[model samples]
Target: MSPTPQAVYLNGEWCTSDSACVSVFDRGYLFGDGVYEVIPAFAGRLFGLDEHMARLSRSLEALGIVPPLKHDDWLAIFERLLASTDAPDAAIYLQVTRGAPAKRDHAWPDASVRPGVMATVSPIGAIDGGARVITLPDERWGRCDIKSINLLPNTMARQQAVEQGCDEAVLVRDGLVMEGAATNLFAVVGGRLLTAPNGPRILPGITRGLLLDLVRRKRLMELDESFISIGALREADEVFLTSSTKDIWPVVEIDGEPVGAGEHAGRAGPITRLLDRHFQALKTRRSDP
Candidate 1:
């Protein structure tokens, strides 16, 4: 029941969260015509800043919306927002919408209308335990590659998982395991790593990319960027999900059934522990000079 943070950046101005508001006619409000990025910062150092910005640019370009600020402008804004928070680790949320139009129309607005930009900072919370996931139908739009503000489908799926006393929702489309509600899915099958390939059906998460890099660097296990069948996932030895906020989390249970096999059955497996150790080392390296 604690109060929400009051520091927010809206349209080139520093304002209280209560005072931050966009026009009702904004396309983002009317039709979710916007894109967003969530950048994580530890001890005020923003991780994957360039990569997140690159993805944001791609999302805006895909939607035909102009970026409101330059790269340096965004860096400055993020610095200011991070300074407003006292937490050692935090997440910065930046959003850009196609501005309000003179009238609500199905078509694009006039070229003169500037895009609406907003940002906020919140403390990053720790993941206390392994995830319990529920497999749900992937009913989102086709353009999942673009980080659009339209997340109703994801919200619904996550809510359903929570209602069932679960921590995450693994989305299955056409018998293929796509991803989680907000995280990318990965599984260990036959002593190899398997995950859905990068495509329109997935977001190409930044953390996911980093993990792939680590996997290749250490040659930890055979990695395959391919579709994992739902049947394969259910029978996998270990299951995990990754994201910017929750770097990597093991899936101990799915739909109330345990994951993995043999000695590690129903527990975080050896491979998961190894990858997590590498991830921690990566974080520590990032914090170093």
Candidate 2:
């Protein structure tokens, strides 16, 4: 793939992608002491950026790291980067760390390590029809709510899914479905929507919120977030995964078992179709003005 022509904001300067690089001594690299947020942009406008930024700020506070830039400053920087890039649909990635210091120790740095903020935009291709997912035993820490950079377990799970000829991996904790490795999981059972509740078990996903809203707006049946077992998913009316990059992707099958195979076999269900249209309409409206 060609390198994206997106501009990047580093420290204080907004420059080309090639010029963006953090210091070797950055704690984020040495100890994974940082947080990041991915904001999806449709057409040319950022979608739910304020929420993303709020999450980022919260992550920083949770990490005891001050935000590198003011909220408005960050927005200005993101807009500049977006305008500099040519991608119509992009995922804006922002990473803030405790900054670099010329030492490696377990203790936090004594002084304010300049928070490192960097961003770039790239294209989001068409959403796939459906995705195959393999379930993995959840091995992440209890603080998954923090959105920290320590993603080894998730990385391995995602890679394992790829190796297993699947599009994504759903993480199961103690035989209960948690969420996807990189996305959130949802299920339709008995014509009702089901998903895990917001807690330490699942990272609150932006697309997940949108899907819930769309379902509510349609007056379709839904269940308050709760634990869903893998066995239940296999017997459910439908299964799907949502994220910033993929939106809502139906899961016709999981781990070789067909979900919602009777009438909605190998296709997006009615609820899925409805939300898909709502999501697209939102994108179109944003793309227009």
Candidate 3:
């Protein structure tokens, strides 16, 4: 073990990650009934933490789970965990789940059952160059708004992508593209940028939201929240995926065909590159203490 003061906050206590224990009867384990948020940290500082907390609170409210702690309490916990991590690039993962009940049951009405929370700071994986993608039917539940711990469909799709030598999977509902297996989808057609409107179809990714704000603030390009069909996505001039950790990914190809045309084919295009640069600049603002 390195000499860094590393530990994880579990339930109401802070302990070493190895010692952070959870009761077997926890609803998060038994029923996948929990919500989670990942707030990206650049260097040692948090980026868009308020936005993340707002999303987390919305998720908790949607699931009928009470807010385990106030805003100040959460800030204290997150900052403490980050202070223990020396990673240049890291993220704060916060999860809140319906507490372990006294007995195993599908539904528990006891208000006394407290929620279980786990918070930690971990290194963010780096992605080199562009990403290859495979599209699949969006076979997830209706309430994608809530960042619930139940991610069976997403995990399966991601695994499928891995088996096919793809970096990520874009999910399609009906005939329209909903989102990626874990990230939000953005397609550049002609010269205009388009992304799925926030709703049950996709999770309001913190990175995605920030990028949208940047685009609007900078007037970088024409953009819309209109739905994108699979055909449109396949024919788009450029495509990208955004998440809390990975930042942005320029999709060079889909299925087996190359994205874009001619010279820029199978490569990161102008708009995608522009957004990535600006987004990185935004991250730097939060870097300095």
Which ten residues in a row are the worst by lDDT in model 2? Answer: 215-224
Error of 3 at 82 (Å): 1.1
lDDT of 1 by residue, 1-289 (tens): 8586568889878898877778999889999999999999987899888789999999999999988999999999999989999988999999999999899998998789999999999999999889999999999999899999999999999999999999999999999999999999999999999999999999989999989999999898899999999989999999999998898899999888899877788889999999999998897788776
Candidate order, lDDT descending: 1, 3, 2
Worst 10 residues of 3 by lDDT: 1-10
Candidate with top lDDT is 1
* Alpha carbon lDDT of each predicted model: 0.92, 0.82, 0.90
Candidate 2 lDDT by residue in tens digits, 1-289 = 8765457777788777766677888888888889988898887788877668777877889889977788788788778877876778888887888888778887888655687667776778887568888888999999887888889999999999999888889999988999999999988887778999888888888888877776677675666688988788778877888888888888876886767765887677887777678887766765676
- If candidate 1 were superposed on the true structure by all CA atoms, what would the RMSD be? 1.1
- My TM-score estimates for the predictions, one after another, are 0.97, 0.94, 0.96
Model 1 scores worst on lDDT over the 10 consecutive residues at 1-10
The TM-score of predicted model 3 comes to 0.96
Candidate 3 residue pairs in clash (backbone atoms < 3 Å): none
Stretches of candidate 2 off by over 4 Å are 1-6, 285-288
Q: Estimate the lDDT of model 3.
A: 0.90
What TM-score would you give candidate 1 relative to the actual structure?
0.97
**Stronger candidate by lDDT (2 vs 3):** 3
